[model samples]
Target: MKASNGTTQDVGGRRKNSKREDESGRLGEYGQDSSVNGTKQIGATSADSSGENIIRTSVTWDGRSDAGKILEEVLLLKQQFLDYVKSHQGRLEARLDESKKQEQKFLANAEGLELRLRKALTIQQTKDESDNTEEPE
Candidate 1:
């Protein structure tokens, strides 16, 4: 029921002591000293408790190096994609125009057939009227 740090725990291994304090007045359960060989503390700044100094460094990439080559390739790929899209669009437009032309040709043929049918019907009617009038002879 008691941990090595003198904190009382429950039967289910849950900590019962809510205010266990360490030497620095920090909670012993949460603020255990995470120092390596008591020299540098984890998540601490560049200074230690005994005034020990630590150096930090940063890294950067030059734009005129590999980064520039990658950017050029990316731009070329983007241009290629744009060209492909434009080519497809032009082909689609041409196909659309061709379809419209075909539809117009079909419509013209339908109108011509309708007109011929009307003329043939009129001629037949006229012939029937003449035949009926000549029946008295």
Candidate 2:
């Protein structure tokens, strides 16, 4: 539903009430709040005394409304995130390789032990048979 006052949609597709700040950082259309820095933050939601939906949109400005600068910042953040993911993937791959190497080594050692055990059992059996062949003396 649309309100009497024009409302704008936010990045999330949710309708912003009717509270918006101008580039100068004034609340709605009636307020004077000057900040030391060039940054201004506005974000809130409430119902005005008139029972109208009010949504304060948050926007940052350094002096001029430069969409290019904002886009650049977003791109830079994305690149940083991608770089972090790549590094993490590389580390995980290294760990997987090490684990595979360890598994192979363990298998080899186990096979060697098994062979030695079988050889020892065979020797014991042969020795017993030879003793039995000898007559009581």
Candidate 2 residue-wise lDDT, 1-137, digit = tens: 43445874444455668664475564354455444578653434243144444343325354677889889999999999999999999999999999999999999999999999999999999999998988586
Q: Which residue pairs show collisions in model 2?
A: 18-55
Best by TM-score: 2
Cα-based RMSD of candidate 2: 19.9
Worst 10-residue lDDT window for candidate 2 reads: 41-50
TM-score of each prediction: 0.49, 0.52
- lDDT of model 1 at residue 28? 43
Candidate 1, residues 1-137, lDDT tens digits: the string is 65867786755765788775565555445555665776746565443334544332222454545877778999999999999999999999999999999999999999999999999999999999999999986
Candidate 2 residue-pair clash tally = 1
